[model samples]
Target: MHFEVPKVRMHSLREFAQHYFMIVLSILTALGLEQWIEHTHHRHAAEQASEQIEVELRGTLDSIHGALANNARQVAPLRTLKEAISDDVRRGLPDAQINQHIRELKNDFVLSVSWPSFATQSWDVAVANQSATWIDIDRLHKYATAYAAQRDASNWVTHDSTIALNGPRMVDLRTRINLGKDVDPVEFLGILQQMINTSTETSGHLEQTAKPIERALAEATN
Candidate 1:
């Protein structure tokens, strides 16, 4: 019941070296091709993300400019209304004229106007898919900062413009103006001044936010 041992074949030293060399070459080639494919895929993703971000940023910049312009236009009329109310109080203008002035002020207020939705679709997608991690760190930082500023400015703008809607402010305003109810000029002036101040602050913030976005765009192009 004894078992016979089988003889094993052995390679010559040169043959062994050649065989290992071929194995090493095959592994290296496979690794190289895999790395090249991965590099290509990452590069393509970055390029696509960049293009989408660039277009979205441009649209955002335009929206900021338009919003700023509209905000500025509201300022002059608000200032005029403030002055007119002051004069009417000081000079004792008729109640009818006062009501008319209130109407004018209301017309100028432009409440309920829509602000531009900051276009962040591409950025959001990049972030959600983790593709933004592939971007240059410095560029990504700048873009992120710009978007943050945009978000803040938008919040302020929306709050300031629509704050009057929170209570009976608009309702009271319309009723008072329509009915020619006697409103204290000083009180109304304060409200108008507050709105003007909010607009000024919002516009300034938006302008500052725009600079970073512009910088981001320049960096992207360069």
Candidate 2:
């Protein structure tokens, strides 16, 4: 690299001191400008990242709300079906009569519980690209808490629906009854009871998760 030295002659100690101070001041000013520019760039990047993440979170929250509503709709009808079946069994109705009644109410006898898998691609990319490091710590904590809640609720639902519950048996019973095949009323009632219980619990966890997400979004807006 080529280097150039300034052509200067100091006439006295005072002149030399002034020249040295000027050089130091110029260097400091240059450094300050560079730091300022870098800080501005980082702040802008952080803002953009935050905006993208928030938008994605809004979509995720919408998905969650939709799922909750759908499950709510499903739970009500499932409960009604269970109650009807219970009554039929209580009245000591014949297997043929109970079977025919269940087949007739096939629409209400159906059970469906759907839960959302929240979108986190934006947040994940921000974290991976180090943009999250620029976010304020308090805000970052809030975001983290919201995402944590989503993850926990998702895991719980997965376990309850797939592992803990007798999902296969329930589906099989539902299919047989819907297809106009004979199913023991008491046995079918038990499965319907399980479905009602599982859906209620899933909705509870989803509602619990929603609270943190709602709070985070509200605070972020303010």
Indicate which candidate wins on lDDT. Answer: 2
lDDT of 2 by residue, 146-173 (tens): 8999888877765655454577887888
lDDT of 2 at 155: 77
The Cα error of candidate 1 at residue 222, in Å, is 1.9
lDDT of 1 by residue, 1-222 (tens): 223333435468887677667767777787899899988887788778878988999999999888777877767777777787878878988766776777666676433222556888999998998778888888889789878888877777656644543335545665676675756556666666666766676677778889999999989978
The C-alpha stretches of model 2 lying farther than 4 A from their native spots are 1-5, 178-181
Best by TM-score: 2
In the predicted model 1, the residue pairs found to clash are none
- TM-score each candidate: 0.78, 0.89
